[model samples]
Target: MKAAVLFETGKPLQVVDGVQIPELLQGQVLVDVHYSGLCHSQLAEVRGHRGEDRWVPHLLGHEAVGTVSAVGAGVSKVATGDKVVLGWIKGEGQDVPGARYPLVKDGKEYLLNSGGVTTFSEQTIASENRLVKLPDGMPDKLAVLLGCALPTGMGLVFNEAKLLPDALESQGKSIAVFGLGGVGLSALIAAYTTQPKVLIAIDVEAHKLELAKKLGATHTIDLSTENWQEALQAICPGGVDYSFEAGGKAETIEMAFEAVRDAGGQCIFASHPKEGEMIRLEPHAFHRGKSIRGSWGGGSQPDRDIPLFVELYKAGKLPNLELLLSHEYSLDEINQALDDLEARKITRALIKIAGE
Candidate 1:
């Protein structure tokens, strides 16, 4: 198998060939990867933002779509030839550990490590829990987003915010999303589906903000040019009913929390800062009914939510969802994709592995 291996943290991934795939263990599924989506999590992993690299020389990637070529012992969530969406989020299946691939260097054999799910390779050994069977005829590229971006984004609004399309208040809810990455824009799109009275998108880039508008943001705030709190305040006097933070910064997390209305407003942050980083907030705000919480994959259940997300996309409820994937890079260009993601040059970069 061919794969982009992370030999070291804070370094470029080495696109290597002939990395040997070992026999699948219990609860594992062998997938021929079709497409992978790059997001901030991969950037953080490559940049060593999470503090340590104990998993060096490992496969990197979480969200992807692929075909099941084989199944391991005791695995029954999916079958051979089943098209599936590979994700980091756990679902109902046999829980298992990461896989190790064999690599030969100058006749010296080495082992490459991988998590329960990885996509930056032509083929991967994923735990059954990380696999979600995709429906027949679904676009592989778009389904790639289901693994992470859409699940987390839509989950933030649906699961965390509990904002249902038909349950919106008569006046509608006021919502604000801080950041414009794939996850943030996804939340923005989900929030839009509820017909929110005010949907504000905040970002440092003009292009992302513009895309937010087209995707359904009633207003856009340029963090580089304006104070987001003031801008948000000007748009919604009493603060928004919900604020979602995906900026991956402590300051933004604090700001997102503070932007919520004092009475029953909620703030949910899907991004995490570097390990050991701290976010400070006023404790008194909790007394006034303002609440903040961090989301784990937007509280998504891959097996359950991915199907719903697919249905919504098919129904055209998530209009222009394809626009969220702003760039595509071949598997060989994985390093460049990471660089662009870190530089905030693209909303989402698709990694074309073995997809048609």
Candidate 2:
């Protein structure tokens, strides 16, 4: 199998044309990847930020969608030829972060269990249960994205924050999204479905705000320009009912603390900030009934939430995420893809790989 292998940290990933397609073990499924999204985590691996679980001369993709070509013993959730999206999870009590994150390297295991996936190759292995089958005829590329970004983004709104159905008083309240990338925008789209009167989309880029408007955001603020707290207060007329930190920056999280209304509102931190980092907040941010919650992989219980996004997309409530796809590159072109993404040249970057 061909894969983009990072033989060393802080070095270019080599498009190794002949890496082994890892054999599936019991309870695993083999997928022929059709598409993979270049996640920030992959970039972190190349930059050596993940420290542990950095596989050198190893496949480095996780966001993917593919068709099942085979299943190993004990696998029953899916079958050969089933179109499915991939998910990466370190099962609870795994090599998760604490004072330290565990490490494995050089063609070795990186999980508490071997079933966690690595999706950056032509054929990959995943836990059978984590693969969500796409209904026949769904757009492969779009469904593939819902496999990751859409679910993570919208799930945070639906499951993590659990926004109430009613907007004002209950129905027309305010919600702020702190980043405008795939996940943030997807959250905005999900928040829009709840009909929030004030959906504040924040980003450093003006173009992202434009897309936010097109996608049903009630207002957009450039976080790079002025003080987000003042801008948010000016719009919400006080503090917001909900503020989400999807950017995973300590600074952005601080803004979330300031944007959320005290006493009855909540701030949801949707992504893990840098390792060993902490956000300093006034004790009062939570004293007046303010709640803080962390959203992990959008609180996805894969079977329940992944397909709902597909249904929502089929009904046209969700933006065709392919619209967010700014560039497509081959495995060899990954470095360039990251460059395009980091430079804000691509709104949602994806790389094409073969499944068929």
lDDT tens readout by residue for model 1, 1-356: 88999898988999989999899899999999999999999889888999778977889999999999999999988999999999999999998998999999778788999999999999999999999999754589889999999999999998987886656362388899998999999999899888888999999999999999999999999999997778888999979899999999998999899999998999999997998899999999999999999999999998889888888888888899989999999999989989898888999999998868
On residues 1-356, what C-alpha lDDT tens digit does candidate 2 reach at each position? 66666666777776654454445567767788998887666676777665754434455677788889998777767889988877764322122111111224355543222226666667776766557777654676666676667778887788887763334544686899988777787788888888887998998999988888888888888977977777777888768888877775777887887788777888887765666778888886677877877777878777777767777777777765556776788877888997777677767777789743
- Distance from true location, Cα of 232 in model 2, Å: 1.3
Model 1 pairs whose backbones collide: none
**Which regions of candidate 1 fall more than 4 Å away from where they truly are?**
169-171
Q: Which candidate achieves the best TM-score against the true structure?
A: 1
For model 2, the stretches where C-alpha displacement exceeds 4 angstroms are 52-54, 89-115, 164-170
Cα displacement (Å) at residue 312, model 1: 0.7
**How much is the lDDT of residue 314 in candidate 1?**
81
Task: Please give the range of 10 consecutive residues that has the lowest summed lDDT in model 2.
Answer: 92-101
**Residue 182 lDDT in model 1?**
92
- Write out the backbone clash pairs for model 2: 166-170, 166-171, 167-170, 167-171, 167-172, 168-171, 168-172
